[model samples]
Target: PGFDPAARPPAPPPAAAPPTAVEPEVTGGGSRLPLLLGGIALVLVAALVGVGWILLKQGGGAAAAGTGVLIVGGSPTGAKVVVNGTPAGELPYVDSSALVGSYEVRVEADGYEPYTQRVVVAPGETAKVTVALKPAAKATAKVLVVSEPLDAKVLLDGEVVKEGGPAPWQASDVEAGKEHEIVVQKPGYRDARFVWTPEPGEEKTFTARLAPALVRLRVESEPAGATVYLDGAKRGRTPLDLEQVDATKQHRLEIDGGRCYERWSSTLIFDERAERTVRATLERSPACATRGDRAPGKKRSSGTAPAPRPKRRGKGKLMLNMRGAWANVWIDGKDTGKQTPLINYELPAGTHRIELKLPDGRSTQLTVEIQPNETVKKTVPAP
Candidate 1:
């Protein structure tokens, strides 16, 4: 009874089941086929992450492209290839295909004098280097330069090379083309030689000329009447032949007054080639010749005459003689030594200032005023 009762009522309600007719099964394109398969699975995961991000951007653009290469070579050919300082050219080396670096290579050549190193090129490197340039060294010899008056000495093969003070005189590193043996001497001159050939690196020149020296002087005077002076000036009596002079030139001799003559001075320098002759004789003279007499280039008057009283045959005897030039004598002022050509002097009479010294320095002073017994002669000229 209970079952029938409920079934009858529920049976009617069960008919609502007809509402289940949901016919939405059109998979061909219905609902856009799940939105087109979920948009093709999101475009296949964004096309596989965009093909793995385009293969990682093509491997990072091939690692930023920077290869390296720097090959170099060398020899004599122009060679002038610097790196750090820049000028990178000339030379067998210059391929600096850089970008992987460590450079510092220099190679210069002229006669040859430059070569440095410090290279390193990696990153796909192709480095190979080689260099060698050396050939520049010289110092030859062939000298002969001198001076002293051969015009001043400046020869090549004959020796005496330079001494003109200033001129086109250059005796550089001789021997380039060697062949020397020059000689040039001077004094009164007269000494020359030749032979100077230079050609290796080339450089040689020459010239020489000299000759002059001859002398013969003589002077005599004693109580026989003294008077002679060479440097001091006076010629005529007492053999004198200064000939061509210049034996090195330097003479000043003197001897004056005679009663017993005794006053001499000498200074001579001559020996260019040798051969000299001189002689002067005179004696006794203590400064005697007082009676006032000044007329020979004049200039002598200092007052003082009265002190000569002792002597026999000539009271205060005095004598002197000289020839040519050959002196170095100063009396009354000391240094009484040196006189040639009849050399003789002696005084004890009065005033006197006889001095003669020559050899370049030059000197000649004479002032005589002897009394007692006098005799003087002079001649001097050579400085």
Candidate 2:
């Protein structure tokens, strides 16, 4: 029967499709299809994730590998190297992908001069630098000692270097461009002095000849009681002198006070052939042992010269021989006569400064004290 449209819709609403065919329950195989399909999808997603992680790690490692490293080598390996002002690790310097930069590199080795270079390294590039080392400087010299009789002493500066030979001396492996002094000396010989400048890697020679010193000394002193010294070394007693000393030699002469003088010193000088006489007149020292009552240049007698008197023969011709000759017979500041021809002079007892002319034209004044009936005899030496 055909139902009305609205009524039929209500009636048919409950008509569930009958469990048409009650089939037997499927086992695990039925659920296995959907589960397996879902599992396959999950496995695919995990594999994709693992692949993506591996790709990411590989990319990071590649970026890290891009960096600049510097390598240095020399004829002598393992030399100390410096970069800029910093001390980089010894020879080969490595960095982790640094930016491009310019650097100054320095290399040093034992017994070699230091070498420096400017280097430009780009990013992701390795730099290789090479350097050649130069040897250090040295100086060598030969010395020839030359002198008369070959007895001179050799000195470097003020220190003694060698003594008494004609030997060959060598100075090796010294620093270059230095000034050195060479001095030679000997007893009775003048000093030989010179200077030398050396160059690097050069061999040089020098010659030196020492000359002799010849001088003389002469000294004298009055009252003759002091000792004399030469250059603080004792030579002799005063009234002391020497001869033929070195001409270029320097000396200091000193005298000591003992009798009538004070201590004094003199600088002696000479030429190639020089004779010099140095004299000292001793005055009465304040510490003199003996005191004098008489003054200097004071005569001890009055004036009246002794002479032979001539007279007529009363009993017998008065025969007499006077000891002194060329005597001036003076009576009160007036010349009476000379005693050479036996002059007659009447004189009274008195003191006198008897002036007698000597053979050498020197007039000697003698002090004479005449007493009554006393005849004094005196002998005169030639001037």
TM-score of each: 0.34, 0.35
In the range 79-150, model 2's lDDT, one tens digit per residue, is 678876677655544554543466678888777788898776555787778887787554555445555546
Model 2 segments more than 4 A misplaced: 1-65, 73-127, 130-132, 136-179, 185-217, 222-226, 229-235, 242-258, 265-283, 287-383
lDDT of 1 at 279: 41
Model 2 clash tally?
12
RMSD of each: 19.2, 27.0
Model 1 misplaced stretches (Cα beyond 4 Å) = 1-104, 107-120, 123-182, 185-189, 192-209, 213-237, 240-259, 271-284, 287-331, 334-350, 358-367, 370-380
